[model samples]
Target: MSSFTYHSLPGFGEQCCEEYGFSDACIIGDRIIVTGQTGMNPITLQTSADIGEQVAQAFENINNLIVHALGKEGHPAHHEGKSGWEHVVKLHAYFVGLSSIRDQARALMVRSIKQWCPNHQPLFTMVGIESLPFPEHHVELEVFVQARMVRFVTNESAS
Candidate 1:
């Protein structure tokens, strides 16, 4: 069996899971898989009560997770690594109260995609969830990126 490595950021608290559970970031060879991210306030470590804010924060958290994962492999953060929408062969977005704010959630996701992956577009699926693991969580996003080794490059180096 191929062994996978998991990494975590300092001062980010404990991994969401224990035992068979891994950290927020995981690496399988050159590919990095980031777990779902939520719109939680960094300071208090609490989910945002507002849906829009939660949506925005979730993307930011995803960005941070990507950056951190890359950094673990000796790459710089925000590096246009081999992962983006095009590289992201699969994406899953879960929204709490999705029926109530489906339009707003989509808009926020579009905004985040524009900001994070402006060059590539990935296949995505959005689902309305009755509730998340956490009551405060209004939105959560999980993404899977698949790319070749050559395409991975730091954001600065890409320019």
Candidate 2:
């Protein structure tokens, strides 16, 4: 049987999974899949009016999910409380206004990657869309990660 780890962060992560019946992030062997993350605040459940702010929040949310999925003490990928961005191999971003906010979004996205994954570079894709699921959300992000697992997980323990 294949090994897998499913995780949902605190706050909105739990609520979303419970209501939608999907996990926020899941690990299959050494590959990690993270769901699309918006700029909405987890606690407030609100997206900001500013596009820059929304872009930042989206990256933050993505990082939070990755960290929870890989940074826990017992997780095979855990690494000294570091940001899980290190394990990311690819990033996909969706923007509400690709043409209008292209420059701003590009700058912000570059800045975020530089800050979060200083030691490695990750593939990235950005595209514009007419709108997002939430009216106020200007950006959404999803990530894929490849990390080596040092330990084995039993089916019973995974549960």
Candidate 3:
């Protein structure tokens, strides 16, 4: 068996975690993997219809969660000219309506990166889907990052 301690994020209740059958974020050893986060506000649990806002929120969520998990909230120092964003191993950007708004979506994502984590590079895969589980959500971001033990990310839901 693997040797690692586990805990759920603090903001949301245990009921929500159990109902969803997943934690907002989990850490094991030197790695902490967080679930995808969307622009949707937890209070309303409603996703924004605006593509730009959605993209921005996605980037924000990833950035915030990673830092929180590192026990260093806010902007942390970069290591070897590498910021938290650079450590992201994989990014899966899922688009609900691609054929019609592919260009717009791409632009939004690029702009969000510039705004959130400037001059950063990470492997990304863009997937075009007819629709997402949440009908109103236009975009979703799944992030995988390598992190050392410190803190836990507080995320209520993706959107």
Best by TM-score: 2
TM-score of each: 0.76, 0.86, 0.71
Tens digits of per-residue lDDT, candidate 3, 2-121, equal 454333444431335777776555655556566767676544565677888788766766665565555532223323334456557667898887889988988877776666555455
Model 2 residue 28 CA deviation (Å) reads 0.5
Per-candidate Cα lDDT values, in order, are 0.68, 0.83, 0.63
lDDT of 2: 0.83
Q: TM-score winner between 1 and 3, please give it.
A: 1
Which pairs clash inside model 3? 38-158
Work out candidate 3's RMSD over C-alphas.
Answer: 9.7
Q: 134, model 2: CA deviation in Å?
A: 1.1
TM-score of 1: 0.76
- Ranking the candidates on TM-score from highest down gives 2, 1, 3
Candidate 2's displacement at residue 86, Å, is: 0.8
Q: Write the residue-wise lDDT of candidate 1 on 7-85 in tens digits.
A: 6544342435453355776777656787777788544687757787887777767666666666667653236553334
Candidate with the larger lDDT of 1 and 3: 1
Q: Write the per-residue lDDT of candidate 2 for residues 12-74, one digit (tens) a residue.
A: 889988998988888877788998899998878987898778878887888788877876526
